[model samples]
Target: MLAQIAEKASDPAGRKIHPREVERVFGALLASSEFWRVVALSRLPVETVAEIIKALIDVGLAVQENGALRLTPGGNARARARGIVPLIERTCPGCTGRGIDLRPYAELLDQFKELVQNRPNAILEYDQGYVTPETTVARLALLAAKGDLQDKELIILGDDDLVSIAAALSGLPRRVVVLEIDPRLTDFIQTLAGTHHLAIEVYRQDLRRRLPAELCRQFDTFLTDPPETIPALELFLTRGLAALKGPCCAGYFGLTYAESSLAEWLTIQQILAGKLKVVVTDIIHNFNEYVNWDYLLESVRKDLSFVQVSPRANWYFSSMYRIETLADYDQENRDRENLALYPGENLS
Candidate 1:
């Protein structure tokens, strides 16, 4: 009977208790007939036991109906979810007992706290105020539904960056190959892959140099978020284009006023003119207000010509852009009709 009790004590969904918490609670349960007796044996006040019961209900373990504690349907399934009970005993170093911990990035943590303190509803990070991580994933789903990534070999350049991380986690591709300049970053990703049992390949290579011949024309889609510099952007665009099997989609942070920004966009247009077509152009708005509006507006004015040719262009003055293409073209009017319908919005 003790052995059966022991086995039941460790059952994940059954009791839904951590090993240590289980030992304590089970001891109490064995000592008393009434629920309050279990609380006394555990040395917790009656109020605390009530709270624990509430938590158990929230996790769908125990349900209270007609003043009786009963196991939920999920509670029965939890007993079958092997190893979960053991996992409860293991605490996350980053969070300790708390659900979230921001001490590692103390500076950013403080900034985030201050930003959200007054305007709790404000959206921050990659997407503008209106866009969310779920929305971004939904958009990727739309792309998938439209066959934008059908049987495509995808090469994700720059894994150490934020965009690369987002792309890695998005899981919206047939296959993904990541190229990162930093060995440490590659190692980190490798560790993460092992931890999550994910099948992702990470290669250590500087994207500034010419891509390996084996990689040339090996991928149908090239996704990059290179450093925000004329030289770096040019290297990624030119070299990335050279490595593509066909037209691809790329995203970048654009500034409207910077001469370097205009030069980089124009250089990309010139380099990809014969081989790639610009299919989609979108600007992402920054919810955290980290975007440079003045620079974005000025850059847009300087490169209005390229903007005119893009099929779809969105003004997220301080956000990012998703540019797609077909085979190269000098002046394809396929997207021109759509472009005329929605003239660029003024960022001023």
Candidate 2:
């Protein structure tokens, strides 16, 4: 049956009817509650999912049952054959907890991609990884939609993703500043800022150092893609928090379970909830995609060698954490011992 379906479609992979796609499409359905016959989609790119839905229906893997998509017996078999049977076993890190279709953002993706085409990928030693261009725009668009971005002062703690460029291009935020450890990124961003005449300021500052007085408490929102380790997350996140404008100010950071263990996440969460006293407003699941990180990630995951073919999936996903300050917050007074979290070694 699979053979026959493959023969009919010249672009089977293009249609999302291929093996890899089943997990995403069927998995979304499986995760939805029984009462919700019509489930909205998230995580997967919208364009690809459209073709997937059509193909699923055609192959009887999906059917219109009471104005909702219901998997047929054949669909169940296909899911199992694809090793996606226990769909909920490994919960979707992307939309694991939060649910609302991101379909509306789909329309603006290509335009966003065109805007950021010139930007480079992540650097491993810098502990940097970036989301897809569309995902970056989607994030800014989502923030704008949430009334968080318009004419707001934004400071990006680290922008390997170059999201500040997208924000500046959108002209939604009044000002965008980036504090990047990588000199290459600072120079490149400065070049782009000059070319596009975007209101972006770049500073080369290692996280281990004290933040500039100009940056302290100067922003309405802070965005960062920091290191995932406990000490690193603390140092980077605190720097981001320091850049925010007092109470009710927001901060956005991306963290991944693939790299950081549950204990690491808990300790970090406790810092935000206990010591930091900021309310975690939202955890947008699997919001960032790092396509170029495979070469860097293989060192950590060690599972990449098993893939005989280049991976087509966006397996490296990050949850976007939005924290809003509830009260007046003081910056951490970290001495020399605590400075080891930064990329470089400590000196005498």
Candidate 3:
């Protein structure tokens, strides 16, 4: 019998046997009376033996039919082909024993650790939860389309996170320069560009400080997702505006509470009103948590007055600028309000 088994194992066809065949062989071996007698004599628990049989079935080596476990034809062939007994085991219980899903933020962080180092630490410091790349990309695309970013020079005020990376990937701007405060982050960004072969200029300068001379009046588009604080807001919007060539497009977070944050967004609008028209106003919500329409509309009203002004500084506020709330993404309503605020094909 041993010689016959050796001959069968030596066959090239057996070596190429399918996995299913091996599973059946295990099932048949376990179901044999001789094997059961040995298992009982060895004092092995019935539950343990049953568990092993179940594992064989789970791995597709054995099948149960008419209350009898048996080796499938393919399982027998696979065992002979492999010239070894296959050990089937139960699937791992932790994490469902399945691999991680690569589509979410957690998986991306794992895969691109070098790009997003110390992710948990950074997130905890920011007190902001993670967002999926898909959601981030979709929102950015919407913003770009609304702002008419194509054929425009964009000035990004921060580069520590995925937003800067997304902007580089979008290729929506004619020229893109990222201004960041941390030198370490700046170095990381440079290394990121080199590793990914992306063309992006990174500047290691504080927003509170005067912008580099080369950046003055050089940007047509502006994107700001600044830190949610009074000092940071003032520095980024006020100082950063100096770099914009105008007409400019920008977005700011409108907090429901804290008059200071609301005031800061308005302050940015006021500054931009002097040069660029507030062409589009979008409110990106923090998930479905809350809406700050009151704060948003207040800022819009103030900014519109400036946009409606005439070329002359004195005549600008005389005529009321028709400030219309264009679009709002409210997670609570599960609906987006898209209103045409201004007339003309250009605004469309």
Best candidate, TM-score: 2
- 286 in model 1: Cα distance from truth in Å? 4.8
Once fitted onto the true fold, the runs of candidate 1 whose alpha carbons sit more than 4 angstroms away are 1-146, 162-171, 247-318, 329-348
Over 180-225, each residue of candidate 1 has an lDDT whose tens digit, in order, gives 7555567766766666554567888765455767776666666554
Whole-model lDDT per candidate: 0.42, 0.66, 0.43
lDDT tens per residue, model 2, 193-253: 8976878888998878878888787889888777777777777778888778789888888
Least accurate 10 contiguous residues by lDDT in model 3 = 313-322
| Sort by TM-score, top down from the best | 2, 3, 1
- RMSDs, each prediction? 23.2, 11.9, 26.6
- Candidates in order, TM-scores: namely 0.40, 0.68, 0.42
lDDT of 1 at 14: 32
Where does candidate 1 have its weakest 10-residue lDDT segment? 333-342
Error of 2 at 172 (Å): 0.6
Query: Would you give me the overall lDDT of model 1?
Result: 0.42
- Which of 1 and 2 is ahead in lDDT? 2
Candidate 2 error regions (>4 Å): 1-84, 88-111, 301-310, 333-338, 342-348
| Candidates by lDDT, descending order | 2, 3, 1
Best by lDDT: 2
